[model samples]
Target: MCDAGLKLPPNNEKLQREEEEVMHGANLTLKLNFPQYQSEVEELSVKSSTEVGYVKLLIGQRKGITAKNIRIFYNGTQMIDPMSLCDHLGVSPPSIDVDVYINLEHTIDV
Candidate 1:
């Protein structure tokens, strides 16, 4: 359901806007899960061109943890930074639903 006050753009204009977004970058909704934190889940809407590192930064800001302390996983495999969500998900669309796991218990030994 859309807001009653919200008005959709004209067909042509809407098409043009969509084309522009496709040319630039689309947005995606990702499910961020914190398995160690009560199975907490949060929905993150970000541009497809966004990197996993940025997502981690966002999550860290929300969780009050350092970005370097967060680990991201997709489909049970660890995700690396510098990889766009579009390339990671391998989908072409403005909207897509994907799940990502967050591990906060990772420790680094100096």
Candidate 2:
């Protein structure tokens, strides 16, 4: 429930090393929450540049849900298809402490 965004410590060697690794195109680890399922995906590794739509697709595939049925929200704002994590959070090379909400669409067939 932290909305403070990413806070980089001053000259923290461990964080510095991790930042360097990410700068070399290392994937970012995200904590994905699925409220309806009452579950969470801890440590979901993804590129900072990856699109929100693709992230939904990836999660959908893994969770056995349809990509079109997924909706992602950050900081109370709904994340659209083209926005990347960097764009949404407005920072990169991150140990981003943001919580993402996943809304699963419940469908009914006639």
Candidate 3:
């Protein structure tokens, strides 16, 4: 219990490191192509179990935009399920490429 009467979780660095190491093993390298933005391409590494919405969040952070404005596509099909895992969407194995499209109104050249 802390001074505020709230129980704090254990700050075990070793446990956190172990968990990170485990997750690292499942990381997938993805090639992101921005066809709507000068045909720009970027590589990103994420966990295989990562959700589509989280991918948008990651890209949004780098592009200074919100996740809601980003759209991800695979195999010429738009990934509509934000909660779907990347691997399940067939965007895994590190060889598949993902297409990212941003709304023209909110597009930022980056």
TM-score of each predicted structure versus truth = 0.67, 0.59, 0.66
Model 2 misses residue 99 by how many Å? 5.7
Q: lDDT per residue, candidate 1, 1-110, as tens digits?
A: 75789687777977996887777577677777767766677888887778878988898788776678777776666678788766764545555444445453653325
- After superposing candidate 3 on the true structure, give the runs of residues whose Cα lies further than 4 Å from its correct spot: 1-25, 87-89, 107-110
Better of 1 and 3 by TM-score: 1
Clashing pairs for model 1 are none
* Residue clash pairs of candidate 3: none
Q: Compose the digit string of candidate 2's lDDT tens values, residues 2-108.
A: 78998866988888867865674446766676566566554567777778888888877776666777777666677788877777754454444344444434532
For each candidate, what is the lDDT? 0.70, 0.66, 0.76
lDDT of 2 at 3: 86
Span of 10 residues, lowest total lDDT, candidate 1: 100-109
Best by TM-score: 1
Go through the candidates in order and give the C-alpha RMSD of each one to the true structure: 9.8, 12.8, 8.1
Clashes of each: 0, 0, 0
Candidate 3's displacement at residue 8, Å, is 30
Clashes of 1: 0
